[model samples]
Target: MRNGLSVDVEDWFQVGAFERTIDRADWPALESRVEANCDAVLQIFADAGVTGTFFTLGWVAERFPALIKRIVAAGHELASHGYDHKRVFTLTAEEFAADLEKSRAILEDLGGVPVRGYRAPSFSIDARTPWAHPILAEQGYAYSSSVAPVVHDHYGWPQSPRTAWRPLSDSDLVEWPVATAHVAGRTLAAGGGGFMRLLPYRFTRWAIARMNEEGHPAILYFHPWEIDPGQPRVADAPLKSKIRHYSGLAAMAGKLKKLLDEFDWTRADALVPAQQERARPWRAAA
Candidate 1:
């Protein structure tokens, strides 16, 4: 099975982990490392002969147009990760719509491709954010890989289906919820992000294999910063945030290379035809 691979293109400081410590107002003055970090990720994919989607932030695109062009030139797909990294649930309907439009426009302009997909920052769309789906559809997004069906302090929609489905029955938008594996009558996140970094590689490999055996293509995601172990750290962050953001940074590159070698990976857009064909009619939890 060809699985989906994605990179959330944002700098270390832009991550939700440091939101409390790093204010948006100070973003302009901060040193930007996303260009170099993302370049490292792009090189790894190129070396492995893999192409994947890049859910790039508008903020990053605007600052690093050359990086956006580089990703596009490499045959990767371009998608929106919102203008800033604000969580969807925190934004009002209007604010979310504007953010989506801004991000999509910026990505399309820089990448020279029709931006058809979106991944909310931190997987922030949950039951409280039903308004997000229609807004996405209205703005012409074909799919969204924004729901993580597990409990977390940052984000999740545990009651949502663990696979791709239509969250809005009245619209054509497909909701590609992040992958999870059923184990011991519970759903364990088998995708990427902190779980992939923190858990044993053996566990992640098994989880993806289990999902694939069950006929679901796993959608895995990581950040550009994951490969930059030596990137500057947020010194004043809380202990928990500090741990989540910085742990396993050095090992990530090796694990990711192993994963790319093991799986037949492709852009998230490549999965669209199959996903649309298999999509079930469903609604998100209220």
Candidate 2:
């Protein structure tokens, strides 16, 4: 069973964890480690003989076009992570549309692909963002890995289908909610990011292994900064944000290599073609 592997490419300073502490106007002054961090990620995947997708920020690509080209050169799918890291929930529908189109244009120009996929910053597309899907379809995105199906203070729509599903009856744009694990009868976030980084590796391994045993494919994701333990710290950020963002940076690389070696992996586009027929519309939450 082949599963989807994804990298959310953004600089360390741009994360939602630091959103309150770091001002957007000050972003240009912060030194970027994304290019080097992403290269290390590419090397890790190469060593494991794995290929996957990258949900990249247009802000990063404009500054590191070479890195964007490198991702495409190494057989990874190139998709949007918005122009800046703004969550879809924060933006008005028109603002979201502009951000989406701008990011797709930048990535398509640099990566030389159709830019058919999008993963919102912070997994921000859920019950509240009903307008996001139509704009995504109109903008020509084929899929979005932007919804999480577990409860969380930041984001999740637990009632939404745990598998890929169409958001609209009329459009082909499918939503691949992040994979979850049923633990003690409660659904938990198991599709990487903070969960993969902060939890014991045994848990993620068992979760994915179980999903595979059930004839299901899991979509696992992590950011480039997760493996760069030496990344600059956000000193004044809250204890919770600091812990979530910085706690397990060192072990992330080893975890990913083991994950790729253990699972059959492919780019998200490859998985979606096989899944389109199986995907059913998820009714928007009232």
> What does the lDDT read for residue 127 in candidate 2?
77
TM-score, each model? 0.98, 0.98
Which lDDT value does model 1 have at 61? 98
The superposed Cα distance between candidate 1 and the true structure at residue 106, in angstroms, equals: 1.0
* Candidate 1: tens digits of C-alpha lDDT, residues 21-137: 999999989888899999999999999999999999999999999999999999999999999999999999999998998888898998899999999999999888878989988
The residue pairs found clashing in candidate 1 are none
The 10-residue segment with the lowest total lDDT in model 2: 277-286
State the TM-score for model 2: 0.98
Model 1 local distance difference test score: 0.90
lDDT of 2: 0.90
lDDT values for all models:
0.90, 0.90
* Model 1 stretches astray by more than 4 angstroms: none
Of candidate 1, the 10-residue stretch with the lowest lDDT total is: 277-286
